[model samples]
Target: MKKIAILNGPNLDRLGKREPEIYGHTTLADLEASLRAEFAATTSLDFFQSNHEGALIDKIAALADAKFDGIVINGAALTHTSVALRDALAGAHLPTVEVHISNIYKREEFRHTSLTAPVSLAVISGLGLEGYFAAVRFLLKR
Candidate 1:
């Protein structure tokens, strides 16, 4: 079975409460369950989350052995600051899609720039949880 890794970072663990207006009222687990149900018959997914940068990197490094065919990542706050995460994704060399539930560009100036965008195959934003599902579909087509 083909496997995909859905990696989330930082404050995203508290999605439902963190930024209810931007991230929606859905918790991360709730969104995961929906994603699983949506992709259940199509592919297997390994879901992981971490508030620590090293832990996220560690999880991604472990996937270097062809364990995951693709990756959908919501790097959260790290998307703007973490070169380590960007480096890990590039080193993995997998088809990667960066997801963002909110429209970063329309918000604060600080959220406008993404350090990881240069290394990603695609960036899906402003569509909330549906953006993640879109990334999954893109992988399916690939």
Candidate 2:
């Protein structure tokens, strides 16, 4: 089975409550349960969520050290701001898929750019929670 890491950053812990209109009503736990149930037979998944940038970077480094097959990440607000996070992903050299619940293009101008997308194998945006499913599927297929 493929070993995959799902890393969520920043305000994503507020998934259901932060902006139901935008992120939908699925809590992070609910989403994880759904993914686990869907892919239980084919993949081993490890999940981590952190509001701190350094913690996230540390997790990425650990994933690299552990030889994870791929990564599915929803960098949340950090997608638009964190060069360090981008560098960590790039340096890790893992096959990564970046996911976004909201269409960054449809939001503020600052949200239009993603520092992490360039390092990811593909990006899923504007599809709400389905973006996470799509990202995991992409990594699995690879």
Candidate 3:
């Protein structure tokens, strides 16, 4: 099975309860369960969520060292601001897809820019949780 790491950053831990209107009502655990159910036969999914940037960076490095096949990351707020996170992704040299639950272009001006997208193989936005599935499928095919 393909090994994929799903990394979520910052306030994503509050997914279901945090602005249900924009992010929808799916909790992080719910998302993980759904992804597992959807891809369990073909992919081994590992999940990590962190409110701290260093934790995320460290996890990415660890995933690289462990030879993970791909990464699906929802950097949340850090998507717009963290060059360190972007660097870590680039350095990992793994196939990566960046996922955003909401459309960043449709949000605040600051969100229109993603520091990590440049290092990602693709960016999935505005498609809600389906974006995560799409990302995993793409990576699996790759």
Question: Which candidate number maximizes lDDT?
Answer: 3
Off by over 4 Å in 1: none
Specify the poorest-scoring 10-residue window by lDDT in model 3: 101-110
Residue-level lDDT of model 2, residues 15-82, one tens digit each, is 89987988888899999999999889999999999999999999999999999999999998899999
- Whole-model lDDT per candidate: 0.91, 0.93, 0.97
TM-score-superior candidate, 2 or 3: 3
Greater-TM-score candidate between 1 and 3: 3
Model 2's TM-score against the true structure? 0.98
TM-score for each predicted model, relative to the true structure: 0.97, 0.98, 0.99
lDDT of 1 by residue, 1-142 (tens): 6799999999988989986977889998999999999999989999999999999999888987856889999999999999999999999888899999998898999999999999899999899899999999998888
The full ranking of all candidates by TM-score, starting with the best, is 3, 2, 1
| lDDT of model 2, residue 133 | 83
Error of 1 at 114 (Å): 0.8
For every model shown, the clashing-pair count is 0, 0, 0
Question: Candidate 3 lDDT (Cα, whole model)?
Answer: 0.97
Name model 3 segments beyond 4 Å from true.
none
